[model samples]
Target: MESQKGKWWKKAVVYQVYPASFKDSNGDGTGDIPGITSKLDYLHSLGIDVLWICPMYESPQIDLGYDISNFEDIHRPYGTLQDMQDLIDGCHERSMRIIIDLVINHTSELHQWFQESKASKDNDKRDWYIWRQAKYDDQGIRKPPNNWRSIFGGSAWTWDEATEEYYLHLFTPKQPDLNWENEAARRAIYASSMEFWLKRGVDGFRIDAVNMYSKPPSHPDAPITNPSMEFQWAETLYCNGPRMHEFLSEMNEVMSSYGEIMTVGELPHTPDRSEVLSYVSAAKKQMNMVFQFDVVCIGYGKDPKFDVVPHDWRLSELKKAVENTQGLIMGTDAWTTSFLENHDQGRSISRFASDKPENRVQAGKMLALMNATLSGTLFVYQGQEIGMVNMPQSWGIEEYKDIESKNFYEEVVKTSKGDSKALEKAKRGLQYLARDHARVPMCWDSSPQGGFSTSTDTWMRVHDLYDQINVADQEKDQSSVLSFWKTALKLRKEWASLLIYGDFELFDLEDEHCFVYAKRSDCNVALVVLNFTKKERDWKAPKEFNGKSFTLLTSTYSGDGKPGELRPYEGRLYVQV
Candidate 1:
């Protein structure tokens, strides 16, 4: 077995907190750092070792906190610097580590650096961000530098009248991509932004879009994927560019200077395991692990970013995604991450499991079981433990607050020319795939405010199902998803050697209804069986373990149902006896 000795993170389970939606402290309708500090005990109770808080840096909120304006300080709505320190202290006091999000790939246009960079052609900070001359047509009409499309849609190069140049923005025009090639800019990002937080006692960071740091050597028109759309998805042209590795390694050096810090990169829409390992392998010294997009992007239709016609991800494909990812860094010094939901994607309960009233609880527990058994470090997004689902039907397109969702919907509107049916279809697409589904306020109870804030309303609307699905309500029922999560985590901690670093052996790969696997440590083996479908499934153990006796460690159901039968969305964990 791989010796993951003394590595706290190898055995640690992470609970991600989306600050604005976690809990509101001062009743200002926004969850803040103080609010996170207030819940330290609750996180400890959930048995998580790390609390990974999303971006809380100063910003215009154009793309939420991802477009950081002042990384050195905290955002006003989030809290002051002292409050952030107190939060770090509180988590440490509870024996839990704290890791804040790092989002330096881009900066808010309102940022001091960007403001100066765009002020004139001769500004010292002009080269800190990407800037290019505008193209001209035969008629002498101005055009963007290339046909590159922003991840948020529209032209990647926004014409900047102030500087008489076009600036690159992989996202919104308000978020200008940083020129990592600039030595001074890289230095400032490390010393002023990264070290400032590390010196203040943050354990590490969940690096935001680390793979997007380097841009293509030259921007050229990409082949049209959507003929009707002018700008095309130029991800292949820019993602994992030539300098991507060099940049991440440089960033890793800064992180390593702070000692055994934990870092997990966000590698969106990349499923190449070999390429991912190059970033996480200890020899490479880039990251501890990375969040792979293969599993979560399974159901995406045409465009992986915004799929208008989403598919219901199948069990067989999902099983392969998990197994393939686990094999990425198995014996190597690198590791992968196990997660189904995050601030970027919709909830696992809605997408991976059934959210129907009769099945939600069981499905939630089953997913927990599946994640806890994976070889990588486990991460649970906020509201996932309690099975919070997608936004309800009553929510119109106007209710969606995510910039990406709104922009994508607007694109659809423009293409359909205000057709009612097309508009509704677009809204439904967003409902299934929007980030707001995961960004909704955490439901603490059945209160009108969903127990998130003292105010009557929140920054974003709380999921209306909060009354039916909440922490307080689930806490009362021992069979609840929350209780099962605690149980699963406790068991995982107890059997870390077998569950975390054991050899992963998958079974029944072609059995579309069931995902079966075993974690083996020498002669000791732990088996996991999950029924992905709603109907009951008759499962047969692999022949290699046919005669072995096993003890049930934890399960989604109250009763041990028939030995060979698994009820809809049921999960079972067992250790060889």
Candidate 2:
């Protein structure tokens, strides 16, 4: 029997599947729920305990599935409610939990609520979303109520002539921010929409853009910085507002009544550590964990061009980030959702490792080792296990579907006098950091269409190297990256007490290119050593560590022994005697 005190997320490894590119069962040229259901066996084989499906909600697909049109229904292209229910049932049958994306902060303008709200000023649902009359100066020229800029490059407010008021949108103009200040709206969203999924037996949710749920009552405009573009408000004033904890506590109270549900919040601009800790604290009635972005900003520096290269981040910095979290928040019931790559970021293989096949394998193994050994719930994006890298420049900007990339090209490149240079710079910027890097289809086999779709033309182009870096090809080779990932995942499962729940200790290995750490429980200890560079590095074991006998749990390197030499990009995990 599972422990009653045990939370499912405590030991879970979640696999994030972006549905549109996962697999296509009906040859529709687009992936659907049935396609995902057909691949449950593959996910199970991957040793994943939880599956986090990105938004498949009803939408216009403007920002892909993020711009939700309906809270309770599946997108028509994906499938019906029955299909969603079937997928949930199937996952439960396989002993895997399912977590759907909850995007309550904003809804598509096409949503019934928005439509009704915009129809008339006296509509019952008018206050359900943020709406305000345009501000006019003495000159009588109307402007947005506030000077807030949308995340997608425009004013945050959009005017509706019928209602004669402007509504707020933090992101794309089509997605209007909900007014959580209204009690009726909050209660209805929580009870009617979210509860609908809990009733359907979904394990929980990975709330999207969770911090933007509320805004300050002051409605103060932001200070201007750039003359050419509208100023971005200091997000802290509105985001993670005064009543955030209260609202979350209510949400948590409702969710906690259910059995062992997990809630992970995506906080865009997190305040101080203490403020963040309060939301995740076990004492607080909010969420199980929160995804932190400190690690994601490692490559981003003051100088744009200087930050573009894949170089080694100081292990000391990594150690400090981990230590800071553990010291301030780890033991206090607030946990973290640890990851290297998600749909929003570039692939770890491309971001952190060399692009060469040999180096890619080692880098993949090392990165996995680092993440799995951290004191948080682990998350692996699709194709990460096979060390999938970013797309090459073979496809032009027209082939890309990411809205952010398109906006950058059009707004920054097209408008610039140095059009050719600007376009090249924009392409380079996208080549490394665009969100589309992870949206590429999962490479299942070496066949045409990367075995994702049976149709001649897919919704998106498959990475050309799929033939050399697919699951079918890697499964047969023991030395393959996929096999290495399987071994590492199995080891993590087997040694959960030490690997998953243990305290982390960063070893002072004193090697610039090497990352070494240890996980310790009361009775056992495990050491993880990784060489992030292409040069061989020799590391000395600590003087107190006298045990020469150690079992190699997993390694990117070929051989093992005393004074072991780690090849370029190699990693190893050892169970100490």
- Candidate 1 has which clashing residue pairs, if any? none
Once fitted onto the true fold, the runs of candidate 2 whose alpha carbons sit more than 4 angstroms away are 1-5, 137-139, 223-228, 301-319, 325-330, 508-511, 543-550, 561-564
> In model 2, how large is the Cα lDDT of residue 409?
67
Write the residue-wise lDDT of candidate 1 on 1-577 in tens digits.
2755568887789999999999999999999999888888888998989999998888889888888888888889999999988999998888889998988889998889999999999999999999999889999999898999888888998888777899999989999999998999999989877899899998988988888889875777888888877788987877888899898888888888788999888887576777887888877878888888878877766763555565456778988888888888667778877888999988788788777888888899999999888877899999989988888867888889999888888877887799998788777778777898988999999988889999976899878788888989988999898999899889888887778777788997888899999998866899999998889999988999877898988779997699999999999999994
What is the C-alpha local distance difference test score of candidate 1? 0.86
Which stretch of 10 consecutive residues in model 2 shows the poorest summed lDDT? 301-310
Segments in model 1 whose C-alpha atoms lie over 4 Å from true places? 304-311
- What TM-score does each of the candidates earn? 0.97, 0.94
Residues 7-99 of candidate 2 have per-residue lDDT tens digits of 668789999999998999888888899999999998899899999999999999999999988889999989999999999999999999999
Clash tally, candidates in order: 0, 0
CA lDDT scores, all candidates in order = 0.86, 0.80
Of the candidates shown, which would achieve the greatest TM-score relative to the real structure? Answer: 1
